[model samples]
Target: MKAVIYGTALQWKLDLRSRALLITCYLVPLLFFALMGGIFTSVMPEMKETLIPSMTVMGVSMGAFIGMPTSLVEIYGSDIKKLYRAGGIPLGLSLFAILLSSFLHLMILSVILLVAAPVFFGASLPESLPLFFAALSIFTVVSLSLGAVLGLAARNQSRLTMVSQLFFLPSIMLSGIMFPQNLLPEPLILLGNLFPAAWGYRLMQGFGIRPLLGLGAILAIAVLACVLLWRRQAE
Candidate 1:
């Protein structure tokens, strides 16, 4: 337990220095939130109510789907995996650490958006902060789990970027954040529903149990992918 704690701390410190991590996890998302928050609230005043949730969803998805995988690919596709195996360290430690770190980062970023939105853009807060955060936590986990699958599956950095965008772009463009899902064509809306970002956006709005189900399905698939990848590498 102590070792895990120490290792996670070290991982967090290393992540602080990573320019890519900083850009994706903090810089880009915050910038997007600031820019888009103003635009949405300006064009559609009623959107102020959902601005925080929408931007936070985009930030979390981007960090998890794009940033997390690139870091994981760098580790798993390099000498890091060999060192872990050589040292008898758990193969999943890196994954766990990265997910945890990403969660913390997302939470902080979410809070910033939550606070700043109302002050800067006249955005409204959620009626239930607890429920909002609970949903955010679930969504973050599911997002990172999907990212783990991508990281485990990609063989190279280029492929990782391509695949991450494949998931990230659809989540952003089709998710109700950019525009109403109702405005989208049926096929695109259906495709968006297949990803967590859509469910996550609804979840934040205090929707039904489908988001929980989506989280479970994504987590299961992520775990299965990791297990298979670990076994294959051990061979």
Candidate 2:
């Protein structure tokens, strides 16, 4: 399992170094979260600590749900399927490749936060550092599951990605990372509650350490991931 996680993670890092898949995964999501989100965060100090909710959780989830999965669909689509079979590797490898790539990108942006913590904002990590790490683990599972499911379902790469992005962007907006769920109109708040992002903020905010709907949500997501992955393994 460690090998699976690291192997997948390293390949993704290399791809960023060697490929054109920049910004969308690396720069854009962070920008959307940190910079774009800062436009709102700049006004709300209370919400400022919740930047990861907007940026990586939202941004990273997009990559996980769309980018990783689309790559799977593309790799498994007709011609590449034949080529991969001839090369003697399996479809699972393709899935792992894409997933690892998404996972690595999650870290790249988080690292920026680490570096920027002192330099840009003179901020130190909140006491909820444990929750922050827990949040990263949640990201890994969320992205992994979405990547795998979409990869399994997509007809082709672009088609899969387009569909994924459609879900991805809206998910970010609804995640309540940029805004709070309690403050939204009732309907929007209901919708936001359905996303991991809302839970993520609840977990990351000061409430992260306290028990509440946020803690319950995090546990639920973790259990859900285990169930889904178990199902996938059984298949």
Candidate 3:
């Protein structure tokens, strides 16, 4: 337990120093929130209700899918993995530490949105803050897990950036955050549903059975990520 705590603290500090992590995790997401929140609530007044939830999903998705993977790739695809072995530390613990640190970062960013939305954009709060945060946490895990899979699978930095963008763009653009999913073609809607962002947005809105589906998707992706990471470690 103490080792885990120490690892987590170290990971947090490293992330703080990482320019890419800071940009994707904090700067970009918060900028989008500040800009998009007003555009959304102004253009479609009714959108105020979903503004916080939608943007929260976007921020978390971007950070987890894009930022986290890049960092992980830098760590695992290089000499850092060797360092872990040399230090007699479990690689899995490092992954968990990264995940936990990311969760807290996303939560802090989300809370910023939760508070600022109402004040700046007249966005309404979720009916149940506890349930909303619960859903957000699950969504974060799934998104970060997907990132882990990509990081483990991609062989190099350039490829990692391209792959992460492929996942990140679709997640935000097709996830009903930017527009109505129904407005898209049926195929696109289905495609969007394949990503966790759609389910997370709905789950945040208190839609029926979405929370369960989101939870299942998150856990399934996490298991897949674990398997992939294990395989990479074995090689």
Candidate 4:
């Protein structure tokens, strides 16, 4: 298990070093947080409060569902399945890699937001260690499993990038992270509920406040994604 753990971590670091994924690990989160913070800090105060969590969801979704696959394609390209099978790398190890990468990526972005949010905009987050962690874990697991699916499904780097952006855009905008779902049309609200990020946003909103239906929703998402992933992998 430890070998699997570190092996996955090493792959994540290697992915971060990849030219294709470098910008994502280093620059994308910063730009995202900055963009949302700058645009809504004064006008949409609550939205500013939710920026960190929103950016976090974006990172996890991208890392797991799109970025991991993108990196996998770059590393393995035309022979990914054969490469892994020949080496006896377990599917669990791949999940560990995707999960660790997604979790660590969110942690780094959180730290950056903690610092930048205060200095630039005088925003301070509520403190509640357990709930914060719980919410993050929920987001990480669902997103990471989804990333594994994307890795298995995509054919190339360009397709992976496209898929990841598709994941990022809707998840970010509809999750009520940068904007509230209430402001959107009723049809959009229903669509947002279908996304794991929406549950994550609710979890973050209630982190220091009160527990709601968020955790159960996230767990359901994780299970759903994993079941579908296993079925696909078995083929």
Candidate 5:
């Protein structure tokens, strides 16, 4: 337990220093929020209600899909893995530490958006703060679990970047964050449902069993993939 905690803390510090993580997780997201928040609210007027969650989803997705996976690929795809084995560290420890560090980074981003949205854009807050944060936590975990799979599965950073977009672009385009899901075509809507971002947006708006179950299912699948990938890398 102590080792896990120490590993997570050390990883957190490393992530803070990583320019890629800082840009993907913080700079890009916040810039997008600052720019798009005004545009969305101005264009739609009604978007103020969902602005916080929508932006939060985008930020979290960027961090998990783009930022976290890069770090994972560095650790698992290179000589670092051999160092772990030589140092008598469990392989799974790296995965856990990265995931936990990412969770904290993402949650902090979420809270910043939650606080900034209303103040800047006159966005409305969720009626239930506790429920909203609960949903946020679940969404972050599910997203990071998927990131873990991508990081562990991809053999190199170049491939990871290409593959990460396969998740990130869809989440942004089809997740009803940029626009209403209902406005999209039936097939597109169905496809969007396959990603956690769609359900996460819904879950944030109003906590419901369906969104929870949807996210739960995604989380389980991602976790299973991560476990399998970790075992393969361990060999």
Candidate 6:
């Protein structure tokens, strides 16, 4: 437990220095929120009600789908895996550290969006702060779990980038963040449900049962995939 905590702390500090982590987790997300927060509020006018949650989902998705996987690839896709084994370090330590560090980073990003959205664009706050954060944490975990699978499964950075977009782009477009899910065609709505972002956005808005079930299912499947990929790498 001590080692895990120490490793996570170290990883967080190291991630702070990583250009890719800084870009994906902080820069792009904040810029998007700043730019889109204005446009959405101005164009739709009604978007103020859900602006925070929408932008938060996009930011978290980018960090998890794009940022987190890069760190994992650096470790598992290279000689670092062998180094960890030879140095008496548990292979899972790296995974745990990276995920936890990313969770913290993403939560910070969410909080920033939570604060900034209201101040900058007059976005309405969620009715319940505690419930909002609870949902955000769950969504972040599910996202990072999926990212872990990508990171562990991809053989290299190029492949990770190509595949990460498959998750990230759909998340932004179909997640009801940009627009209402009902505006989308029936097939698109169903397809959007396949991604965590849609369910997560709904969950943040205080919708019940179905979104929880959807996110829960995604989390379970993603964690299982991560386990299987880790085992494959271990072998």
The CA lDDT of each predicted structure is 0.87, 0.59, 0.85, 0.65, 0.93, 0.94
**Model 6: ten consecutive residues of lowest lDDT:** 222-231
Candidate 4 lDDT tens digits, 1-235: 7878688778777767676565665476677667767877778776656666666676666555555567555544466555776788765566567557656765666667666876886675746756776777766666665565566566677887787677667877787776668999998877776667777777765653322354356456656765676666645
Q: Write one digit per residue (lDDT tens) for candidate 5, span 30-97.
A: 99999999999999999999999999999999999999999999989999999998999887888888
Error of 3 at 84 (Å): 1.5
Better of 2 and 3 by TM-score: 3
Estimate the lDDT of model 4.
0.65
Kindly list the per-residue Cα lDDT of model 6 for residues 138-200, writing each as its tens digit.
Answer: 999999999999999999999999999998998889989998899999999988988899999
* Model 1 agreement with the true structure over 1-235: per-residue lDDT tens digits: 8768877787788888899988998899999988888889999999998998899999999999988888788878778888987997776777788778878887888899899999999888998999999999989988888888888888889999999999999999998999999999999998998788998998998856877887677778777887898677666
**Candidate 6 total steric clashes:** 0
> Per-residue CA lDDT of candidate 2, range 93-168, in tens?
6566666566666666666765564455434465666767666666555556655665665657667767776656
Query: Using lDDT as the measure, what is the rank order of every candidate, best first?
Result: 6, 5, 1, 3, 4, 2
Please write out the lDDT profile of model 3 over residues 176-202, one tens digit for every residue. Answer: 999989899999987787788888888
In candidate 5, which residue pairs get closer than 3 Å at backbone N, Cα or C atoms, i.e. clash? none
What lDDT would candidate 6 get against the real structure? 0.94
- Residue 60 lDDT in model 2? 63
For model 4, what is the alpha-carbon lDDT of residue 159? 82
TM-score of each: 0.95, 0.74, 0.95, 0.81, 0.98, 0.98
Query: Which model scores highest in lDDT?
Result: 6
RMSD (CA, Å), candidate 5 to true, equals 0.8
Q: Which regions in candidate 3 have their CA more than 4 angstroms from the true location?
A: none
Give the higher-lDDT candidate: 1 or 2.
Answer: 1
